[model samples]
Target: MSTALVLIMTPGLAFFYGGMVNKKNVISTMLQSIVCMVIITVLWGIFGFSLAFGESFHGFIGNPATYFMMKGMLGNATWKAAPTIPLLLFAMYQLKFAIITPALITGAFAERIRFNSYIIFLVLFSIFIFSPLAHCTWHPDGILAKLGVLDFAGGTVVHMSAGWAALASALYLKRRNEANHSPARITYVMIGTGLLWFGWFGFNAGSAFGANALAVTALATSTTASAAGGITWIFFDMLRGRKPSAMGTCIGAVVGLVAITPAAGFVTVPHSLAIGIISAVVSNLVVEWRTRTTIDDTLDVFPCHGVGGMVGMLLTGVFANQHVNAGNTTGNGLFFGETHLFLVQLLAMVGVSVFAFFGSLLLLKITDMISPLRVSAEDEELGLDISQHGEKL
Candidate 1:
């Protein structure tokens, strides 16, 4: 059930990214979002899942020999990380996460990347970037897990990696030639946001690994955070003298979802509200700040996902309560008279940011050598829809 809901988020993302680009590149933008679903699915089935979830290797990555080609995932055995469910089900659930991670970076280079080159990057990122992070954070005996770092879902593994990669991609790819333009379709964005909002219940709640109190709490927190984020962004926009915008609301809501993901099961409902509002405000400031710069992070992925994920991780360290979930291996936060978790989260954030940013930069350069990463100047001006995919609507 949860796997199905999470899968819908990719198409939701497609529409969300598609609507934000200009008409000339709309189809190519959506296709980038959708294609990862196809490519990553195959990669995950082969060895990606093992690299992420198989037995540990020096506390850094999983041992591929354990489940290469998913050799031992069949039948009714439960996974070690999530006991009580079929092992295969757990693998399927994580696959949804793998698909979306690369898809999210598409927004940063939406209009100027070569389609074939993007396909290569998608595979490379899943193996080198996403898999190692997932192993360190989510694997039972991994490094961050041993350090008591808490990421209920994937603030580090998914959002932070994608956010840093988005920044790297924007910097490496450089600015788009076309000037900033209006969204091609506000209606498409609205529809996409609605789909994303609906699917997020599964994204957060399902992380609980069962239909239980924690899942219910996560569901409640997800709803509260998104609502708070959306409203807070509107107020911030008003303060800046810009009219309230449909696109702004949609982006804000998604930001809230990203912010709450790491902290949902650990923090209480009230703190979730704070997480949403503060993250929205901070991301809004960053987006505004970005306008005066030359870095073309086309859709503000770093601001909304990277910075928002950081805010959530910080707040999780601040607001987490041992009483909320007794299963917490890490103890309470500073508010509860402990300072260890907060410091650990900071270190983890810095480490992951360095890894993802430099790792993605290296991947971009490597992939460029294999195949030029960007479209030709003439093809870019002609638009990716006509130049790369040879299709238009």
Candidate 2:
């Protein structure tokens, strides 16, 4: 059930992003998301899962051979971290995450990127960026795990990585020919928000790997943070003299979800509320700042996901309580007078931001060389739906 919940988020993302682009590009934008479900699944079943969760190769990545073609996943096999669930179930659940991470970046390059080039980048990112980060963050013997870093869900592995990649993509692709278009459908955005919010319960809580007090706490925190984020975003807008809008509310709610993800199982509900409020405000400000710049991140992915993920990670170091979950073997957060955990979180955040940002820029360059990353000017005016897919909305 949790796996299915997470899977729905990709289509939710499709509507969320598809609704925000020019009508001419709506189908193209949505298809960019839907394609990941098909592409990443085949990759995961082959060697993608192994590269993320198999025996670690010196704390960087898992050995691809460990689970090649799902070889050893049988009746009794189980992941050590999720011993109660079959290894196959664990692998499938993790695959949902891999599917969404690349899909999230589609918002940044929505109207402009070539479908084939985008496919190349998605495969590269899953194998090179997503796999190593997942292994280091979640695997028992991986580097960040050894360093006592905590990510209850995937602030670093999913949101932060996608956020940085979005930034890199915006820079690499430059800008759309017609960049000032209104959203194709605000109703679609509202519906997508509902689905994303609903699925996030599984995204955060299911990380606990079983029905337990920890999953309960994660679920509770995720709820409060998301609510706080939504209200705070609209209120913040009003404070700045802008009207409270549906778009602001939805974006805020999602930002809250992203911020709470890494801290859901580690912090109390009150702290989760604080995390949501802080993350929404920070992301909102960054979005405003981004618009003043020449960089064209079509959907503000970096400001919302990247900054929100970073805020959540840093605050986890500040508000995390070992009492919340015994997994906090590292120590209490800075709010509890301990400094070590906060320092560790800060170090990990810096390292991940650098790697994800720089590595993605390199991948974009390579993809561009293999095939043109953008469509021709004629296609730009005609719309990607008709030009690329031979279909229209």
TM-score, candidate 1, is 0.99
Go through the candidates in order and give each one's C-alpha lDDT: 0.91, 0.96
State the local distance difference test value for candidate 2.
0.96
Which lDDT tens digits does candidate 2 get at residues 278-375? 99999999999999999899999999999999999999999999999998899999999999999999999999999999999999999999999999
Residue 124 lDDT in model 2? 98
Give residue 245's lDDT in candidate 1 (0 to 100): 95
Off by over 4 Å in 1: none
TM-score of 2: 0.99
- The candidate maximizing TM-score is 2
Per-residue error at 216 for model 2, in Å?
1.0
224-243, model 1: which lDDT tens digit per residue? Answer: 99999999999999998999
Residue 116 CA displacement from its true place in model 2, Å = 0.6
lDDT of 2 at 120: 98
